[model samples]
Target: MADAADGARTPAARLRALLAAAPADGPVLAPGAYDALSARLVADAGFSCVYMTGFGTTASLIGQPDIGLLGAAEMADNARRIAAVIGDVPLIADADTGYGNALNVARTVDTYERAGVAGIQLEDQVTPKRCGHMGGKEVISTAEMAGKIRAACEARRDPDTVIIARTDAVATDGVDEALDRARAYRDAGADVLFVEAPTGEADIEKIAGALAGGTPLLFNWAEGGRTPPLTLPRLRELGFSLVLYPIGTLLAATAGVRSLLETLRRDGTPAAALGSPQQMTLPGFDEFTELVGLSAIREREARYS
Candidate 1:
């Protein structure tokens, strides 16, 4: 296993470097990974960073929605495993409302930092928080959310570990209120500010205009969600530092699986699906084994033998 001490940059350090080197006029696109294999795939595809989506993780792990079904420990363990596999590739994990209050936020930060995440995102949703893009979302008071951000900042062991504050106030209060909450979060020591589920391009531009110069802002390019989808160039033009595609891969995988299952049911075989140009080719046995580190395990076994 590759350890951080094996002449490798720590995950936090790598993340910090990526953030520092990010193009001032463009955004760093970090795609979400639900598991260790997905994280490795993200790194292999040459992404500078990876985002751990709570929605994807919950769906992949337990076939559940992103409605606060997973607790802090479960989320942290998933993050730890993903970080271990992706070694040195900075992981920005979703730490959803810190699972409770300000003290809970502190513990959540501590857990994520210890789990090797480069950044942890905390939202301002109420306890048992639903997805930001979902309806009927309500956010806590701005002062309370700001206090949680402060707690998260204070609990970080590594100064480079980013504290991202996400405000879901747009759904409840309005864009103006959301922007206000973001400013408060930034004042409370949030390293990155995210205004969740901004409905239109105008609001997106407003978020960047208001928050971009002072603090690094995050844009969510949520597919099939409330937010209007914008190109990377456009988002960068708006001055977003980090852009997260939280469920693109997950949704793609879901579609692929559904297609394969439908084809199998119709033909009673995978031959047609495998041969289709639109379908992804299945990995060979050797390639799949190597992907999971069979070669490294074999080398260790040989040394023992």
Candidate 2:
């Protein structure tokens, strides 16, 4: 839990401080959280930040894949909820394609800043963007994306609120095009650069070698995705500043739910599920109650009464 002084600071300010103070050798690791509960778990587990993954959010909310089904309002509302629950922990949210053009991009940035997100990731894919690792992805022109980046940067009320520009050109065009777009986005005032879904170690190295040291580089460690699962030390050595384990918490929670349902169907009790290490493990009842802030609620009630 964050102390009083930490809690008093704005999420954006806290995030800026964290970035400024982080060691070059150890990049900040932000785990994906699908909802308020999952975000709370991430915060309680002591992560420096929590990432609001559009993929997991789409799946959790609508039982659908992340093919840009949800609109800007839905994403912003989810970000507000997640930000509320995780006190003092910075939220880096995915603002897919900024929902439209430059004007729309500005509105998205404003809405996200008001939602208390510390970082907003804008990708170069079309309006209806898919997951970075998925096939059949297409990107807009470099000049268009650069304009959107400028819009996003100009729209933020808090200057410290990070504008992360992600280029998916690796899937559509090639690694060279992706690198060129990244440079353009960086020149357009993107605080962080995300070259999404590099296929191998060579691609990753090329990205770091080309774009690192000037602006922070973000690595998306999407589990079971196109990118190879590289270690933290390796990414740090490459000068990457952040790594997002998007969808890991969602996958873990999904597996736990499946196990519990299976145990109930087979044994007619949750007892066996809790008894084995291989089965679903849940926190104790009181432990979870406290984790979700029943203690704080009770304290407030007592003060009022």
Candidate 3:
């Protein structure tokens, strides 16, 4: 894993510092990025952190849905690329079901930590898990999930590398069952608790009320997902310490690409849409190059020459 600019503090240490002094007004907002370019965009936009969304990764990498299609190696390689580009910005990655049983989870944790992710979210969903918002999801037993959490905790070399425990019990069982599962995960040594896909605002509040005030809580503000969206202040008041806007970037990029393709096909030119308000919002050619660190590359080349 690459060190921060100081060359001493690792990305995990920076994330731990952020958590230690996190504000009460709002949870850390981690926007999802599918590739190194999108990860750079998130960091350049001044966000302190970025998230590697499994949904976006599966979509971008294989043009498939997030159906447990990709394995540990694929996810870790993508994490490495994003981590390399983002420099000091902490990355929180989704390690789906830890790719297998308790032993697999341990290896997944070690691999992701080495890949430079500051946090790894492991869910209780059964193997070959689909998106939390999607139907036909199932969760493993509480004991089994707790065992996974312990294995993850034991496997990480950096104690600051957070192990986030997510429960898909709300979909399979009920909110109460989800809360119970979350509590068990916490007891099993999870650094953060994530109860995935609460269908209503009431359920959201119920989750925070039940599991908050002890371990740090995570909220998934996944765009167009099953969970109802809430304002940051409301989530803060509900006691969430981290909020993930997973899939928003992917959704917006998809819409933008589709619109451009339609314009090109119809008008035989993209000039009409190029200067439109929507396109105007995008960065220009030179600005994008600078954003991607062309200046830094040029400086290095000049030094060598």
- List, residue by residue over 3-55, the lDDT tens digit for candidate 3: 23234377777776666545443577899999998998899898878999999
Query: Please, what is the whole-model Cα lDDT of each candidate in the order they appear?
Result: 0.86, 0.90, 0.89
Candidate 2: give the clashing pairs: none
TM-score of each: 0.93, 0.95, 0.94
Pairs of residues at least 3 apart in sequence or in different chains that clash in candidate 3: none
Give me the candidate number with maximum lDDT: 2
Each candidate structure's count of clashing pairs: 0, 0, 0
* True lDDT of residue 182, candidate 2: 95
lDDT of 1 by residue, 61-158 (tens): 99999999999999999999999998777899999999999999899999998898999999999989998888988788989998999999999898
Off by over 4 Å in 2: 1-8, 23-25, 276-280
The prediction achieving the highest TM-score against the true structure is: 2
